[model samples]
Every structure is written in structure tokens, then in C-alpha cells.
Target: MPEHEDKRPLAERIAADIRKKIMSGDWVPGLKVPTNEDLRGLYGTSNVTIQRALQILKDERFLDGQAGVGVFVRGQGSQTIMPAHYIAPAGPGQPYRWLSEATKRQQRSKYRMLKVAEVVPPVEVARALGLEAKSTAMLRSRIGFLDDQPAELVHSYYPVELAQGNRLADRRLIPGGTPALLEELGYPTRSQDDVVSARPATTEEYEALEIPRDVPVLEIFRIVYSDNDKPIEVTMLTKPSHRFKMGYHLEAS
Candidate 1:
């Protein structure tokens, strides 16, 4: 075979094709997949090949099978997340925008505060927050859940000068998330820049998101700015790429 030839297993290739259709919205949620005979005919393969391909989709949660019935597309199709919706601070007595957004879609949402402490952040985060090499920053790590399933892992870092001796360093949950507290601390978020990328999940991410090894994770590195364009926060968000879609809307000036 040529160096550039497709070398993946036959079943995986078939599953990849089907997975692409599902992710591209060609196969909408709750739509029944074609019968085994239909699939075999379409691929000109054997029954075992079709079964193996279908099983792969089932494992990835793209399809669900019912005894004595056909397989249907899972209802929790890829969720499209609008970054703009999560940028604002929650209003008084209101839940965080992310939680509220999930509620609006009738999905239960919650967050688990995983860790809160002063620790040396990742090099990129350190640089973004203007911290000296090896300097410590306040780190707050959490996992966001939708309908009892882990949806995203978040690591947010704040400069020591800003978080020290403030509620930001507290281990407990903030009433309206960090943005509200930041605003109260006089660092109202003015704007933010986000860089998105896709990569294989790290060991910690794989365990946290409960995803298969084949699924990649999406990372959003965000730097939030305050007045005078000072960076107030640097956040890294990780989510299962196969289960989530990032949506952006830009208005013409």
C-alpha cells in the first residue's frame, strides 16, 4: 500500500462515514438508521461488517438499538454552544448564564467545584495572565454537567494580586460566578478573545469527560480583558468534540 493509503480498519472507516453524517446534521436526532440489509447493500459488505460498524456508533453514543426494532439516532445530538451567551455575569439572584442556558433547553445543569487554590498555572495561562515564570496564581477548576453528565471541564486562573485576600480565593462556590465577583472587585469584563482548537484528550480530560479514546476534545483558551485592555482572567475550557459544537455569530458593522 502507498504511504498515504487509508489504513484504518474497514469497520472504522464505515463508522467514520456514518459518524460524519450524524455530526453534519444529515442524520438528525431520533431518525432511524437504515436497516442492516440496507447498510450492507450500501457498503457492499457482509452482515458482520454492518454489525461491527453499528456497534461502533452505539459505543460512541451516536446511535441506540432497541430489541425487535431498528436503531435510532440518539436524542442528545451534538449541542451547539454559543460562546456569547456565557460571557456576561449573571444578574442579581439569577443562575449563571451557562446553567440558565441549559435550563432554557430543558436540560438539567450543575457544576462541581473540583479544586481551588494558589498554584502555578500552565505556561500559556501564566503568560496570558502576565505572571512571572513559575509564579503562582489562584486556580479554580470545575466540571460542568448537563442532565447529570459531565459536559465540560473548566480551569480558570486569576492573578495573585487580584485574587489574594478576596472572595475569588475562597474554596466555596461564587454566588454568580467569577464575572459578577470580578465586576464587584472593579474588573468588569470589557472584552474577551478566544482561540479554539481540537486535540486528543489528556488522561485527566479523558476521565473527567467519560469519552472514548477515539474521541477528541475541543479546547477554548480565553483571555478576558477589563478596562484599559488589562487581562483579568485566563480560562481553559475542554469539552468532548464529538458531542459539542461551537457556534459563533458575527454582526456586520
Candidate 2:
């Protein structure tokens, strides 16, 4: 006989059950979630643990709770309206295969240029780029929509001398994409570093993505280096946790 393994933490297991229902479409968007007291009894847990379970789904954007109306499911079809970290194809002779959305998925996405200007870099960005504190860089900010859903907000920075008076300063998609454009101009991206984190959305980001203020975001800062090892581009991208997810595949070392 099985050892009757029930060692998983109560709150996590409770949250897992709710998460499954939402993901499996049994409780789809607008469907009400079980009440706190109901969940408490089902899992034989206290009010606090039950509340914690619900909070997990809320954080994941799988459930929305109205003060008086209780909690309801939120649809999960993010891929229908999201973009991948790498959004370009690998050219002939390229060593690595580019990971991007399918052609149909690409057609469903759109982007808007929000701003393009020269600004003194933030301290962290300045450090990343090895620039003086007062040095200015060309900043290009934009928002992307996938299937009419706001999917991401990105801000890219480059040395002003390299970006000014170029298409990178213009408010539109450049031909062959930015990486290709940069390569044609001799700053080919040879490698990049990415740092990922999550936190509550700021007011501006919350509004841009139309997500609740309490919703956390997956923020990634990518610093692209040229063949000469110069930091040529730094981009910060924010994706709503509820509206986006990421996956990675790696070969065994």
C-alpha cells in the first residue's frame, strides 16, 4: 500500500487545486471561485491558510476578487497575445536557432513607439553601460499589443552618439528589426546578459498593461554586447505575470 503521502504544505496544495481548475478551463473566465469558508472546510485549514491560497491565484491573475462579489476566474490565453524574448529569425550561418513566435502568432501582435529622447541614464543602467553618471543616452520606449491585449512595455537605451539622427531615434519599426539594423551599422550583438525579477507593478506600468496594481510583473533587463565586447544596447522589458509566462530549454552539460 502507498504510504499515504500528504506531506505537501496545506496552502500550496489548496492553491494548486484552484490553479488546476482555472488552467484546465473547468472554471473559466467570469466563473466564481469557491468562497473562503468553503475552501477552508474542503482543505480542513484555517481562514488564514485559505486566504493565502486565494491570494496565490490572485497574484497569478487566475482569479479576481471583488470586495462584495467574491472571487471569479480570469481567462488564461496569454500566448494568444504575447511575444517571446527573442523575436527574430536566425540567418544562414548563425550558430543558434532563434526562438520566436510562429508566423501566425507574429501577425497577431502589434507595437507602438511611446517616446524617443536623450536622457541621463539611471544609476544602474549607467553602471551596466559603464557610462559616467551625467552621461546621456538615447532612450526609446514602446508598448506591444498581442491579440489586442497589452503584452509588454520596453525601454531601450543606447549611447546618444550612436543612436541620434538614426532610425533608432525614429518612432517606428526599423527595417529587418533593430538587431539587424544594428548589425548593418557594425554593432552586431554577439552576446547579452539578462537579469529577471518580480515585484508589484508601478502605477504607470499598471495603467499601461491594464492590470491590477497588486499584480506583480516579470521584469527582465537585457544588456546586449557587440563583438568588441562593448555594451551597445540595454533594454528593460516588463510583462504582466497574469498575462505572460516564460519557458526555457537547455541542453545537459
Candidate 3:
């Protein structure tokens, strides 16, 4: 190959070359990429240029740098591109069932219903549930565990008309939980929309989930709707970001 001196910035050129190597499988997952020294010698560039190139790869989730260990390639197959703000879709069904299935299949956890009650909705919650302020509603909370380790916290709210006087609102109702209860009442679930984001956790959240303060939490806001387009429930789920990875497949719009 001819040594043509392209006018692009040194960092940009280095990043492009490294990307090509990855795409061509020259550097596979967990493989050590070229070090700063190696890059400096190969490209006849300064340390600054090499550092910038490495940073770019890291930001793209293609690489992870350990404190004492060198930078290693992160397999492309495990990469997540969603901004963590988009919600996952849940089909119509019992609210508890939808949550339980997601926890089992996606997060790999065992879910346990913590509490259920018939109570007046808070102002913000009432608005989301499309009910009058302070109107009665059903509230449910659950904790998910991965082999005894707490993994996620889930809180769900349902309209009083759909939840009150139902077996789902009974505190002693466990095991099959909400989904089964709803199905028994002839109100099978249909679909749900998930909204996710990342943020610092509150003290209560950190303690309840048993996570460190430095660990970021993934918050998912979900709205479960029925076949008639009626909002059945609104739920909030939280988990440690490092403990779980979110995935989605998209096509050209």
C-alpha cells in the first residue's frame, strides 16, 4: 500500500483504521487492542492522537478500559444502541404476568410480589391513571431477585374501577400474582409501552436494591393499555445499570 498522507486529523485517521480492524475481525471481543505506544509507533502520531482515538471507541461501547488491565474489545454482538429512554412494548395481559415474564426472560430474575392495596391515588399518579385527584386506586409493588440477590424494584398503579374489590388487590394474593388474578376476572392483558432512562438512585432505592451509591440505575416507566385502548396501569421499574443490558432491533423508517 502507498503511504499517501491524507489531510484528515491524526485522531480521525487512527479511529478509522482501528474501526476497520475491528470490522475485519482482526481484533475480537476480549482481545487487547493496540496500546498507546503501539499506535504511536504504527501511525507516527503523538500520544494525544492515540488517546483521542481510544476515547472514541470507548464512547461507542466497542471498548472497556480497566483500572489495572489494558483496554479490551467489547463484542459487538452485546452492544446496546438505545438511549435508555425508550420504553419496551408489553402485550395485553395481566399486569403482573407481563412484569413477571419480562423479569424472567430478559432480566433473568425471580419476582416476588411485595405489597398490594386499594388506596387513593396521589396527584401525579391520578393524572397518569386518568382519574380524579385523590380517587381510589390499586397499588402494587414487587421485588425481583437473581438467585437471592435483589435485582429490581417494581411499583404498579391501577385504576380503582379495574382494581378495587378484585382479588388482585388482596394483600394475601401471591404466587400467580396480578396477571392471573386479572385473567380470572375476565380482564386479560393486551399491551404495554416501556420508557427507560438512567439516573442517580435515591437513598431509599439504593438501600432497597442493595446497590452501591456509585452504581447508576435504569428506570423504566411503563403504561399498560387494554384492547379497548383503556390505560389499565402505570408502573415504574428500577435496576442497577451494570447488572442488566437492554437490547432492541430496529429497521429503517
Candidate 3, residue 46: the lDDT equals: 91
lDDT scores of the candidates, listed in order: 0.92, 0.74, 0.68
Error of 2 at 202 (Å): 0.9
Per-prediction CA RMSD (Å): 1.4, 7.1, 8.8
Worst 10 residues of 2 by lDDT: 95-104
Whichever of 2 and 3 has more lDDT, that candidate is 2
Top TM-score hit: 1
lDDT of 3 at 135: 74
* Overall local distance difference test of candidate 1: 0.92
Checking candidate 2 for backbone clashes, the offending pairs are none
How well is each residue in 84-164 modelled by candidate 2, as lDDT tens digits?
Answer: 346342454432121134343453666778998889978888888889879998888988776677888889998877786
Best candidate according to lDDT: 1
Cα-based RMSD of candidate 2 = 7.1
